[model samples]
Target: MADVILYRWSTERDTWVSASEVEEARAYLARQGITTSALPDGRFALAGESARAFGAERLVFLGLQQLRGTRSA
Candidate 1:
């Protein structure tokens, strides 16, 4: 398995939205003027070096890659 990171933007709205409900919420991100890319293993990498050069927290986007070893499917 490979480690993946997801970059998430803070919501300016006072309310919350469900993940499934906001899967197509790229528009909300465009409003922030930040360009992001969703990477393999469900990770999101920063497209720019501005704002904060940070990685994901709580295994949300900073987990180590699972080494390929002997295993049976």
Candidate 2:
């Protein structure tokens, strides 16, 4: 399993939209002039500007750290 980070963006009208994929999330952040950084723990961290723009109330991390281990089956 791959460790993927999820993100949700809020429009100016206050409507929220969830990213369907990692790339989508990245693109959205990029469009907002946000830069993402890879942390040593194998997680992505949003830049300060991005974080502020995303708003603590509007940003959500779904299933974060759920893919920390390999699946056996």
Which lDDT tens digits does candidate 2 get at residues 5-47? 2222222533333444444555555655656654454346677
Task: Report every candidate's CA lDDT.
Answer: 0.34, 0.40
Candidate 1 yields a Cα-based lDDT of: 0.34
Best by TM-score: 2
Top candidate on lDDT is 2
> Compared with the true structure, what per-residue lDDT tens digits does model 1 show for residues 1-73?
1211121223342223344323333333444454555555553555574443432331222221111221221
TM-score of each: 0.33, 0.34
In candidate 2, stretches whose alpha carbon ends up further than 4 angstroms from where it belongs are 1-20, 49-73
Measured by TM-score, how close is model 1 to the native structure?
0.33
* Clashing residue pairs, backbone N/CA/C < 3 A, model 2: none
52, model 1: CA deviation in Å? 9.2
